[model samples]
Target: MSDPHKKIARKAELSKISSSFRRLSSRATLGAMVAGAAVLMFIAIGVGEHLATLALRENERLIGNDLAASVDKVLDGASTSSRANVKTLPGSPCIEVERKLAELETHLRYVRTVALVENGRVYCSSALGPIDVPLSAYVQARRRAKDITLLAETPFQPGVPVLAVFSSTTSNSGVLYIIEGEYLSDVLVHGVRYGAERAAFAISGNGVLDEKGRFHTAIDADAPYSTGVTSRAWPFTILVASSPSLMTRQRWAFAVASGAIGLLVAGLIAAMYLLAFAPRRLLLAAVRQGLKRKEFHVVYQPIVAVSDRSVVGVEALLRWHHAKWGPISPAIFMEEVESSDMLEEVTRFVLQTALAEMSALTPAFPLRIAVNIAPRDLQRKGFVAEVVAAVRSLPPNTTLVLELTERFLLSESALTSAAFSALRAEGVRFAIDDFGTQYNNLDLLGRFPFDYLKIDRKFVSQVDTVGADLIAGIVALARPFGVKVIAEGVETQSQHDGLESVGVPYAQGYLYQRPATAQSLATSISSSAASAQH
Candidate 1:
């Protein structure tokens, strides 16, 4: 009986060991399968993205080359016709030239209107209807140069789009043109259909939409593209867009298959390593702890006066010093904050900190604090009231400079205007930050009772060196309207002198002083003011 009991115990032990080995083998196999799936999915995504990018880039190159070649052909044809009209014509050549031009127009129906420019004046024109031409510096420049200037989709007439191509015929003589009126619609329809597989469009420098017939995606031609020419000219942008539905379906299918395989593989690998490595409970714990411990801090950059180099204002810049990530840039963190819907909290913290710092400063100093207001903040319910309350909390002498960027300000005209008025009522000075960088309505400046016009850094950077006429015109426009011009990015003494020479009373840049903490700013200002007095 004792021998039989011992035999049963031995059998049970062997069975237990066998079961454990089987479990281990199954986990290992599962892990391998998951890893293989993950690798395959990764490869597919990489290949798809590469293919899409290559196709789009190649299409853009091809289209640009074709358009340029076509333009050259058109110019050559026009030039030949002009010479022929001069050689053989009865009576007034102008009348005969007009008749020849009419015949040419009928042949090239796509060419909207042809204008014969001679002696810096448009002598003759033909179109579907009469169009009024606005006198502009660009037109004057073209006339003076006697060189062919192609302006794609310029709105010479209100509610009408036309392509203007100016070409020189001989020395100091030329023909100015307008083309693709009704044909523009046809071209857009055709182009968009052809390029439907990829996102693409073309634009001119004067806020003209030349995207064939699809006016929906047509941005202001004057608006900045991510790349290409910085100066005003019609630059054609071709975009190749992927089908969203197809992408979504592919992603979903891949994710499901890959995720299941990855989980199985990871589980098997984790189990095998469990004996050597403790479960990664600490990593998850650390992440949870980090989320709770996250905090934000503020830094200040001074916006000083160009003339006396006096510290007039400070822009409050936000910084996040994450424990794990160290320091995250405002651009990256702000994106996260916005996506998380915690922007109001961030904005409150920044405003409160800046106002508190400024309030602690000496009353006699009278420094303005410029706070960046995001577009989302402007649209928030009770946002205007919150701003009013925040301003009230600050010292009476502390002036709040609401710096509204062009992109943010003009998005919702009625909402922005109301917000602007509300803030202005609280003695908050409004400044259009990055002025002249976009196709902004100058009339909007007149409409909005803004106290200061902060000329964009781009314009300021060039004012002293190259763009004198433009700078002069901007200063002239601002002066009479009681709007004080504050030139930003005044890096050189020459820039400062040029701005001061033109009566631009205020400025700010690295030349004056870098941004500092409130404590450092006080010391800097005292020293600056003393130097000015001396």
Candidate 2:
């Protein structure tokens, strides 16, 4: 070819080839991006479904626990009635026994009738007044051994479901209390909160009571869960479950939103990952590491009796010192740790270390050692056993008080109630910390068994001001509930004097002594013992 003409043609051909290569590369890049987006969405859908299932299961479990607690609370009344000691004998005139029975029934809530049994026969009744029915007719032969007998119908009240609670003063003499089924059914109806349509309360093959209060002769195979919650105080179990279709709907709803996010989020995953996990992860990991390195310790602030100004108890407070970050205020890292699983470990560390420190002192006087616990710690596996073991480890003269801090409202579940009952039985006491500041203050006192109510420091700080009326009101409110009031944050003599004037029995704060180390607390204890001896 000629040199100039050939060069022009070759340049044009080169340009055409370059343009084709650019078009192919654009198509391939677009295909890769589309594939990545699809993969991201698929992962998002799977993760969303998994999370939804977990959330639903947790909700079901919580509701089930609550329902069990409610049933226990109801039955607890009848159980108390059965144990009543009345001077009116079973063979006494129907009117006198009926009057006594009616009086006793009024004292026991949810109780319909209080009948007296003599020689295995019902001689005096509260509802029918004189009755001559055999106790065997009401209590089944097999169920007679237990405290409760479930009756689908009674001879006097036909077609009514009732629980027969028996307490024996002697082998032949006892009290029989009737609790209507409708009251228990009310608890069941409100128990299913998270999209669960069917809920039932059953007592070990005796019968099932549905949300409608209809008593079934037998438990349905389908309604009861493989893991139903059983009440510790009573022989009842709760069933709670969301429908399969509802679960599928939940998964799909979560999946669709997650898939849409996945399409837009693929480009920003790195930033989002950091935002989701950085601060919590970094701080939580440090806390875990700090625990292992013994960077955490507890200090005790003396809780004193307001009248006598004596060191009655001390509350254990946790402190941490990070190697890299220096001293970290619990206010900063604890919030991060508390929401994470690592909170369990931090709580255990503080509880165990605090007890160990107190054991070393073993002062002559009986000192109440108080430790704060998170709400989650109460329901965790081995929690009650852990506390019982710690309680046993303490000296007989020393008392251990678990102060439940009100960072979150503590849910009253059967498991929690069981924990409280077991520990309280073991002589371990409980106190509701930060009392006035939380939501549902009255509900907490009424629901849980607390030995003392610790007034939130803010109220104590205002003892010299407007909060005195509130303080007096709190003390008065606690009086009916029988929970002794202890004020926290007594910073001045005037505040202390105001707290005393308002009927606050006990208090703790900087006014008496700031939080001290174990060594200091031990020395103070020895001094207090010496003073008491003198």
Candidate 3:
């Protein structure tokens, strides 16, 4: 009997070892599969980006070549027309020469003026009645020496720059044509679909001409993906500069294709995780559906003055009620909302609902409604306008305040600053929410003109100890800027008293009242006001 018992124990031990070995083997296989997939994804992205870059470069080169050929054809026509009719131009009557030149000018669109230079002066002209200025100052000696040669020069016609084409006919006289350099800009840019930021221009003999006919001494050397081609007929070079959007379109196309392929490959390698991840996909789908159905709501937490313990305003918070998941916390869903394009929808809903509901439940004191804004929201072009429209329905004597955290304000952009200034002009106020958590708080404080700074709960929770001294320092620091200091998370009477001793004028926490529905808050405020009258 003892021998049989020992044999049974040995078999059990062997079975345990086999299970451990299988587990280790499974983990190793999964690691190898993940590493292999990452490498393939990296290679695919690199190849796609490389191909896109090549395509953009090729397109730029083609543009240069086409522009150069078009200019050459126009110049050739001007040179040929003058050479064929130079004999009749010289020694002819000024009226007869002007009539013939005018006829030539009518046939060509770019020829602004045509004249015949006799000796050192212009003898006759198609546009100008008669020329008295010396022609030698504008044209080179070679134009007079050669039998037939075309030369371009910079001669100011009025205030605009004109390209003077000197075509030599004989030693005594030559055919002179003045072309508006600005017209070249229209010719080059016609029917082209370059992006808004793109700059297409031409450079000739130390002078640059933009698409709008504006002239400069130099081109923008810092333009990305820039390239140029020299004209085959003349010394002019056409330069093209464009943004990375030209290639990003291709990169996106390849990325989407690779992503679909990667998903299929992953399903084959690890079917278990794919099946497990299905629930997450379902949850995301439900959240999307909830947004469409208007299953989200807003709640307000009363921000009471530490000095009076009465509600001065309320902070707006979003609440989501998933049909299957019951009540979902804002902390869990807000990150997801911010990551997707749904952030603007959520912000508009909260801002509209908070202002409308709170405006109707106006208390005795001026009700100030504070709304939290994410950094990405301010990056949009119409954010300032949107905020202005949202607060148009506010009740009389009420103020709308925007609360921004220090992290977002530290790297405050020019657009963000402009938005703040514009909103401030419209009577909207701003506050730095959850201050003192980041190292750049002082930098942001110095840069932006803030009306209030709310201390983070982490600092306010330790009010009896070092937190009290820290709060005092913050209040003193903000004293000069005329910024009010408010402490958050005043859960107990001791914490509130300590903060008040440190001169904190305002706070928001459960000790005064927790976040409640708008209707409940309206009733609570009315009851408190009646009690105070008694």
Candidate 4:
């Protein structure tokens, strides 16, 4: 093979290898982002499940505690009623016992009836008049106990489920208060948002009473996550049965949170990747060092009075002279930082430097120093506060104007609008930068409170009769709305005369003077002021 052919074939092989490396690099970055998102989602689900379990257990214990307290209350009421009417106990006048029992039944909503039991027989009752039914072994045991006891049974009226609380008196007798068993059901199964279904049961002796006081389980015996709590004062225990729906809902919540977190994490990882590769990495590093070492600087271009051609104010422009990149344009670095979330810092730097420089200038007139603001910075909650702080040290007579490009102005949200309103209240003015370039100029003029409309260079470059008419129309349209018009890129005598004839108040371009450093601009202002004094 010839030597040239061999060299050409080797070059083709190197190109393929480079392309393969690029593809691998991109895939590796994408895979890392996907893995980070997956890990975040799994962590969210695990944390949520653990929390849901805790909440379910806590809720069950609370319900059980409430049921126990309710039983204690009923028992106390019955005991009080029985002791107050001991004179009518098993003999003598039973009228006092009947009257007390009737009063208790009327006052307690859950209470079915109140009765006085002695020697295994009901002597007097609130609803059931004198009964001789045999007391079961469960009731007898409760009658002998010193504390309150709960039992479930069929009511004396037959076929109705009832839960009875027994409190033994000092006279070897006991007081009984019967309540509807569904009271326990209502406490167990009502008003919980997470749990799908719930059931409650009362354990009396060795048997479990269902929601309706039947001798059976309130839920299936093999129900998942069965929890129970024993009463402090009574022999009864309350058991709560819960389904899986509570956990399901919690998982759903976690899923939603995880999705949002995953997206945020993925976006952050992608941004990191972008910052780590090639020229961007070097650029970001340079920016960080530049900011740290105070390498970023600003220049001022004089905005002139069109009729007199005198310098009225200056527009601040950002510049960065890197040791490596050397004299980097703000259009490049600013866009880089904006995409990388460092725009706020850069904006703050520009604002602080511009305000300080303008303050030091102390021009003869109240110069309106205009600072460009990005849309993202304007939307931030603290943007207005930052601007206010930056301008606080300036000369009271000097005016601060915020200049926004048409794209940024159109992207204003409610928060940005509110910020603008606040800044306006503090006497800060706003201007629409590069106005005749976008189609929605009129809409923007109406929506935002703009003090100045600067025509773009393209429109002023026409330099003909039609250009004069367009500039005049804009100035005329803006007059009634209290907005002053300025022309940009006026390089020739014809453009200057055209703008002045149309009554345009201000102009900024190379025709007057190109943008200069702060020291040079200050010199020109001083030179002009000294000349005026002569």
Worst 10 residues of 3 by lDDT: 143-152
lDDT leaderboard ranking: 2, 3, 4, 1
- lDDT of each residue in 329-399, candidate 2, tens digit only: 68777767767898788888888988888787745456788998877777889888888898888876678
User: Per-candidate TM vs. native?
Assistant: 0.43, 0.47, 0.46, 0.47
The residue pairs found clashing in candidate 2 are none
Scanning candidate 1 in windows of ten residues, the lowest lDDT window is: 225-234
Return the top candidate by lDDT: 2
Ranking of models by TM-score = 2, 4, 3, 1
- Compared to the true structure, candidate 3 yields what TM-score? 0.46
Q: Give each model's whole-structure lDDT.
A: 0.60, 0.78, 0.71, 0.70
Model 2 superposed RMSD (Cα): 26.2
Could you give candidate 4's per-residue lDDT for residues 41-76 as a string of tens digits?
Answer: 677667666666676777666766666576556555
Q: How far is candidate 1 from the true structure (C-alpha RMSD, Å)?
A: 24.2
RMSD of each: 24.2, 26.2, 24.0, 21.3
Shift in Å, residue 151, candidate 3: 99
